[model samples]
Target: MKEYEQNQQKNKEHYEKVYANYNLNNILYWLNNLEGYLDFVTNYETSWSALYQNDFRNRIKGKKVLEMGCGDCNNAAIMAALGARVYANDIASTSGKIVEQLNGSFDFSHPIVFVEGDFLNNDLASGSFDFVIGKAFLHHLSLPVEREFLKETARLLKTDGEARFFEPAVNSKLLDELRWYIPIGNRPSKFRGEAFRKWKEEDPHPDRSFSSAHFKKAVNEFFEECLIKPVGTLDRFRNLIKNRKWNGRYAKWALKNEQKLPLFLNSKFARSQLIVGKLPLK
Candidate 1:
């Protein structure tokens, strides 16, 4: 327990530094300039809002939403804009300030409160939230921590509320093997070597890339009803078309077609998984 506490503190400190150094201006510049492949890579929050339009605009309206590890709270901002009362939680103190800055940029219809603390041991009331969500957060945790975090999420959510997460999956054995062969210098131009080195130095938790089967097993242990959707096969191939003038159009077409493919194909080769689970009503 002592060692765990120390490690958590270290993780907290790392994130604090990350948020402190975060450049919103630089990010906006990249978003505006990165035409096709890079734009697709960086715009996940926008994609998520579009992907679950019905839920965001209707089902979760006027709902109490808790976003775990909400980083800069871009998703929380979206939820707030859609009329959900959002509680955005993160380990970094600077996260709240960033969220505040983000809130200032938009005319949000509902409240968004930034809660700074560990999600596993926060003072947030149990059975309080209508929906819980996270993106790109689960894979950063160790298996034990993931289990504990899910248990805590279950505890905090209302009996009928659902938890949703978008996480990276180790779906392709071939792609996984190929990753081992690709030299660091061969990476995309956007990933500068110095920036990559700095990120590696500051990142306390590296990607553990969960497999679909293992993640399903873990979720089943905590939730009664769970659905895991695997989407995107050969999705990374879009990167190859970066030099083409019609890269954005090709990337968009690839994305649309990838989602139409059968789940079996996606499960074998998809680069990510969207996991949704509901707690049984008492």
Candidate 2:
């Protein structure tokens, strides 16, 4: 198989194992306290804050929204709760079960439609959606696969539709190089030679370009407008804080202020990004 195909299969197996016995208690709690949950994540969580920026919460109500790579279906459930006509896709069949559980447990304005298997094979109609969203998802795909997905996004979206993806940003080679040396969780430091290589072999994320410049250029052909917003430049440091409350406070402050810095600084050093595409060429 080709590299992208191999990565896709790896991701399928990986996420299936990761979410196999997933509990819905946390999601249930959030559903019960929906407004409060939305307020907290949108204000303090880097990925959530970035993806929901520019009044996304308000705009999606009663709109057709497709979520690509909707792992665990938490965001899909949240969007459904917010009154969007949500369609979610994921390679893992386990995600479909999660969606089913959410629909059975909650009374959404419209139940989320789960699309399983490969994204490119979906029979979704053209110009059928008002919005397309993916949270921390694009970086998992190889560049060639990503281009195909973007082309599909253009075909599926209305002319005035928008695509929002919150993804990792690796704009500075120096910062990225240093990041690999500081191990997180099960992954060993890059200096670990064979150990690191073995871990990378199993890692689901494909080795691909993640620069904001590349993203901007890649989407330009499919969409008339592309905006790349840097996120977590300072919020990335919250990982160092041991106190949960303090970390949350710092993240909110950092995310808010990081945007105020000169664009050049944020573009070069931000830990994550929110890429927005509008006016689909199709």
Candidate 3:
């Protein structure tokens, strides 16, 4: 198989394992207390905060929204709860099961439709969505696959529609190289030789560019407007805090203040970014 195809299969296998015994109780609780949950995501969580910036949580209600690479269905359920006609696509069939469970339990204004299997093959009509979004999703794909997904995003949305993605950014090679030496969670430091190699072998992400410049250029090819917002520059440091509550508090503060840095510095230092692409070049 080609690289993209291999990556797709790897992702399918990886997420299936990750979501194999997934419980919906937490998701259900959040759906029940959606307002508070929305507030938390909007202000506290790095990925959701960036993706839902500019009053997106308010605007998505009663709109046709498609979520590409909808893993675990948390965001999909949240969007549906917010009154969006949500179409969620993922390679993993296990995600479809979560959608079924959510639809069965929640009284969404519009139930989320799980578009199973390859996203490119989905029979979704053209110009059907008001918005297309992927939360921390694009960086998992090979560059070729990422471009294909962008082209599909362009084809899937209305002329005035926008595609928003929350993705990891690696704009500074120095920072990125430093990051590899510091291990997090189960992944060992890159200098750990065989251990790191083994961890990398099982890592689902395809080796590819996650730079802001690369993402901007890729999206610009298909969309007339591309806006890349830096996020989590300081928030990335919250990892050093041992206290969970203190970490959350620091993240909220860091995300808010990080944007005040000069644009060039933010572009170089931000650990993550929000990509907004509009006006599809049809």
Q: Per-residue CA lDDT of candidate 1, range 1-282, in tens?
A: 565576678878877876885656644443234344233543332245223533444677789999988886656765676678889999888889877776665556665788888787788888999888888788777777888888888888898988888887787777876654334443422235676556556557655657888888787787897888765465556555556656666656666677678878888887677788788333
TM-score of 3: 0.97
Candidate number of the best TM-score: 3
TM-score of 2: 0.96
User: Which residue pairs show backbone clashes in model 1?
Assistant: none
TM-score, every prediction = 0.79, 0.96, 0.97
Candidate 2 runs further than 4 Å off: none
- Provide the RMSD of all predictions against the true structure, rounded to 1 decimal: 5.2, 1.3, 1.1
Candidate 3 error regions (>4 Å): none
Q: How many steric overlaps are in each model, in order?
A: 0, 0, 0
Per-residue lDDT over 35-104 for candidate 3, one digit per residue giving the tens place of the 0 to 100 score: 9998887788888889989999889989999999999999999999999999999999999999999999
Clash pairs, model 3 backbone: none
Clashing pairs in 2: none
Please state the error at residue 93 of candidate 3 in Å: 0.3
